[model samples]
Target chain A: MPKPMLKRSVQQTQTNNVLSVTGNQKQNNQNQQMNKMKIDKLLRQKRSKEYMDALHKLDVGGHVHNQNKVDEITNAIKREFPEVEISGILLGYVSICYLGKPYEVHTLDIASGIIEHYKSGETLPNGMEKARGIALHGGYEFIEVYVDCCRAVSSNGTVSVISI
Target chain B: MSDRVISQANLSYIERNLSAIHGEIQALENDVDAVNNNVKVVYDQVGVLANEFHEFVYEQKKANRLGQAEIKLVQIRQELEKKYGHYDIVRRTTTGILQADDLGIVKKTTISNATEELMISTPNYWLAPCLVALSAWISDQPELAEKALREGIKRNDEKTSLFFAIICMRANRKSACLKWAQRYLANQDEENLDRKAIIVIDAYANGLMGADTEGVISREMTKWLEELAEKPGFVEQQTTQWTEAINLKREPIENSGYTYLPKYSNTWPVLEDILEGANLHANILAYLMDIFEQESSSAPIKAQLDKILTSLVTDFDDEELPLRKKEKFEQFVVEFCGDEDRARQSMAIEETAFETHKDFTQLLTDAAMKPESSHASVATQKFAIALSKEWILNAYNDVIAQNRMKIPTEIEINVDTFNSKTTDGQNEAQLVNEFTQLVTKEKEAALAKNVLTGFDKFLLIGGAIIAVLGVGMIFGNPLGGFIAVIAGIGMVIKHFNKKKQLVINEENIKKNYEQKLENGLQIIRAILAEVVDFRIEFAEKDDESAKVVDFLEQITPDQYVKNLSTSNRRIKM
Candidate 1:
């Protein structure tokens, strides 16, 4: 009876050892697969446009626009705001302000153009016109355009294009 | 029966023991497997960490390389900016010359060219910084100017001398200015020999020292003007044209059938001639203004000049001359009024105070009206002609005077004194003869003295070959004698080889030095381009971080390889 009991205990111990070893191996394999997934996720996050935009926003105050697009937008602005000083445009665009007034509409139009041009490859040749047309089409033509543009600053200090 | 009982018990005991040992062994094996797995995990982590570290290092190095390259690019750009900026100054100086020349002030040509060349050929290291300093100097930023000038000197830049001279002059450091001027004069090539640079230097030095340098400056100015005047068809042709125009008679002489002279025919040409003559006169007047303003001026002399000016203006309205002559007369009046002092004074007056200087204003108004005279029909006919003549004559005289003083008739050197004091053996007689010859020949002086010295050094090396031949002859062996004979012949060949080599080396040195300077200048230009681009890009960007990163990425490689390759081709002789 003693011998049989001893043998039974030994067998139970061996089985336990094998089970532990197999369990640990399985856990390790799972951990590796999870880590790989996490790395892939991080890489995808890094490469995303949203991530790049966030990085850019942190660095410079304004959104980036191609030189040609900027010229077109400025030209449109000039046509709309003929009475406005050209110096005002440069300062407003660069500092995003115009004589103590926020340049939200101008900033937003520039941002929308950047996104349209870079991400969707959509051409916004007449960004100012489209913006004005949209506002007019929406029955906001009676609004003072320059003043409205000035009042569209967001909480993040970025100017919004819809007001223009 | 007893043996069977004992064996069964032993078997049972052995079996139980074996099972326990087997269990222990399995546990140990599992432990080992766990340890192995942990090691694998550690190894994998370590490998990833190592790779990341390596990449970080590589990235750092890349960034550093980029930074270094950017720095180099900036340096080059700065150099080029200096060079081109100086070139711009040179261009402006050239433009000034052209303006002066077109106005018939050709005496300013040499000085203008020298100034231009000095600006263009300035070494990169000095050019940019010096230009910045110059701009600063112009803007009255003394500290910045000094910093720039010091930096230029530190770089051993050629522009250092020019900048040093300019700064010294500006700072009223007479001794320093003179030192630099003398050095410049000594180094000046033949083309630089009648250049205004020396005159400018002298004037600046003298002004700083409070020395009366007027006599010297006036003399040089006169000489240059005289030379210009001597040029055929300069003033005479214009005078003739004016004479012919004024000589034109309105009425024809009633002659017996065959008329020898046409009366009205001479009138038109005479009027045209007067108009032409007036223009030449205006040029001379303009030249005088430039000289008087630039050379030196005292308040008293400047004041006395006012009276002389008034007389010239009053004479313009003298109605005794013919219509054409009157027109020419009015031109001379306007030309006289165009003098720098008169213009400056006139311009200095407030518009509201036009009544205060009624006499001056009336004179100007009268001259202006003469140009619009109905009788002449041609606007500014008299004033234009006279102004041109005056400006041309003044310029010609000033140039002639300036040249006479600046050009040295003889360069004296004490051979014993120079040789004893300096390492260079001063061959005074030879130097003096050469100096005299150079003044006459002009062409030979254009080549640098270093080139000539290099040629002489090569000849000396050639002569030393005989020593080698003599050595071979000292040996008694027949083979040595044969070698000596061959060596003597070889010495002669070597002499020719060395002479050719010396010329080639000197040429190469000059060429290489110029190339290095050009490369350095090009690098500076590249930097300026980057700065311009950066400014444009930054202006366009809304995100500061993105702009910064973009700018960082825009760093260009700055690797300038100065070629110092010495060709090893032996002489065929």
Candidate 2:
């Protein structure tokens, strides 16, 4: 009697399990996958944030070392390409090659900013170095060594530069 | 009277002459008054006579004399009518023989009889006899045709031959047309070809004369070419002609094509030469294509034949030139109410059309270029171009040589410090990569030169050496050792400061190198782009010579006949 009762109990448990598994299983499975995807995305974001924070620390140290370099580039731009600080790259080649001079001193400074056009093609040589060039890109351009940098300006003021 | 005169001459010369002159003056005055009175008396008598003369002269007799004068004027008008009136009959009959369904000689005697009557009335008119013969031939009266044709030839053989050529062509009598054309060409010298010969040639070249199956007409034209081409400096003359013609097709090149080359390169002149030379190929092809692509002239045969016959009748023969001139002057005088000056001015305005002669080669070019002005059809233009293809080929080859000579082997890229050249522009990526490596080496050299290196290491080593020496000195001489220690300390401080300066210098160099590398790379790449365009355009245009050759190669007589399929359907009766 005890053996039969145990088997009967096991059968009842199996049937209940089958009904529960079939009923609402599709809905429950979708909910489980969605929750798992959300958890995984959050973990990835947390990892990426930690990684970026580490990278930012490294970049900060690099900036501290190159602080003088940035200042030096700014002074060079003031000396060679004075207006490039305010004007955009449309006037770059013309400013460098102005006055029919094929070669000119190229000192450049670039900071992230929206591009604005310099309509006047006017340029003045200010304490320009002789016989050397610092390649200018985006806003300042004057340097030419043995290679050419091809560039295109989109309508929305984005300058796409490709070095060949 | 002699004695009285002698007595007056014998008196004092001056006084005697004066007195005699006064007496003569009085006598002349008296005579004038006497004549005035006599004029009055005669006027009164004439008035009386005028009244009686109407009674004496009969009205019927006056009318009879006036009628006789007008009758003589009518005869003069009939003579004038020969030029304007009777020629219409002959021309209409001749044109009708081709267009009218019936030779109509037996059924419709009206026009043929009128043309026959013109031969008798206008005996000296060359076309009159020719038209009579053409009519008789249409009537199948072979005997009558022969006699009148003999008369027509004797009068003006050239006109007779041209007349029959056009007539036979219009009649669709292929053999007779060729024979007549050969007869006309036989009498022609190249220098003195008649305008009518040009018309005949236009017809022949247009293939309006149907399929010249025997090629006899082509042989005749070839003979004319052989003779003309054999002349001194003929080839040279043709070369000059074609050179001018081809040179006209060349257009001025605009500066907008090459954006950078003009600014940076001195190689612009050579580049311009090649570019313009290439442009000529497109221009020449487009010019020919514009003509060839036009719808083939689909003028019906009757209209085309009518235009030819109209050219024949409208043009006067040399023998009838005086009569035609007289007729024109007479007509003008009548039109302008006998105003001789106005008549002469009017005649001068139309005088240029009187030139009924043309040089053969000049005619060919004129017909090709100004087809309408030279009275040429579209087919004639095509034929003229086909005929002169050899000359065009010669000139085109010369054009190719001259321009190809100027193509640069290498293009120079000049922009400030970036001065280099490229022979091959297609491998832009490889060329760019190579340029970058070269610049890197150059930048390294510059950095070595501009920025001091190894000085920091030297300073550090020197500072340690001085410190060790000071320690050793401290044992021997305390004061000296103390001073040495202080100096070493100062040296070590200076080394730190020097190392800082070195970092700044290095930063400056790196920035300069990076910027220069970027710009230089861009410059070389941009210049290579222009070179690519130049090389591609030159080769593309230069290769057009083959197309021209192919164009010329396909223009055979057999092919020309094939092209005539459309006209062939409409040409034959």
Per-residue alpha-carbon lDDT of candidate 2 for residues B1-573, written as tens digits (9 for 90 to 100): 999998787776978788999999999999999999999999999999997887556444444544553554466557656555665566565556545633333443554686777888676777888877866776678898889999988988877887787667656676787788778888887677665577677667666666677876777767866787766545446656766667777898866477878877777777787788778878877777776666555354336555656767666556556666765765665566545567688988766553567766667667665666787766666767777666555555545544543556557777665566766576667767766777788778866765434765566677777777888899999888877777777777877887687678778877877887787677667777888877776778767755764675566544442234432322222
Interface RMSD after interface superposition, model 2: 28.0
- Taking the candidates in order, what DockQ does each have? 0.00, 0.00
RMSD of each: 50.2, 40.0
Off-target runs (Cα >4 Å) in candidate 1 are: A1-164, B1-172, B190-267, B286-573
* Per-residue accuracy of model 1 over B1-573 as CA lDDT, tens digit each: 999999999999999999999999999999999999999999999999999999888767655655554455455546545434443444354344324433553443354345435544644434445555544554456896678667766764433564455445434555565565444434433222321342232232224323323333223333444554454433343333333332221123233121111111122232223223323333433432332234322222223222322222222112222332423333332444323344335434522332222121122222222323211111112222222333322222222222111211112222211211111123334534443443333323333443435545554455456446556666766667666656566665666776687678667665655554454334333333333343233223212322322322332211111111221211110
Candidate-wise lDDT, in order = 0.37, 0.59
TM-score of each: 0.16, 0.51
TM-score of chain B of each: 0.19, 0.63
* Model 2 agreement with the true structure over A16-117: per-residue lDDT tens digits: 775666545866887766654443222211122322232123212221235454444334434443323323322222113221233322222243211111
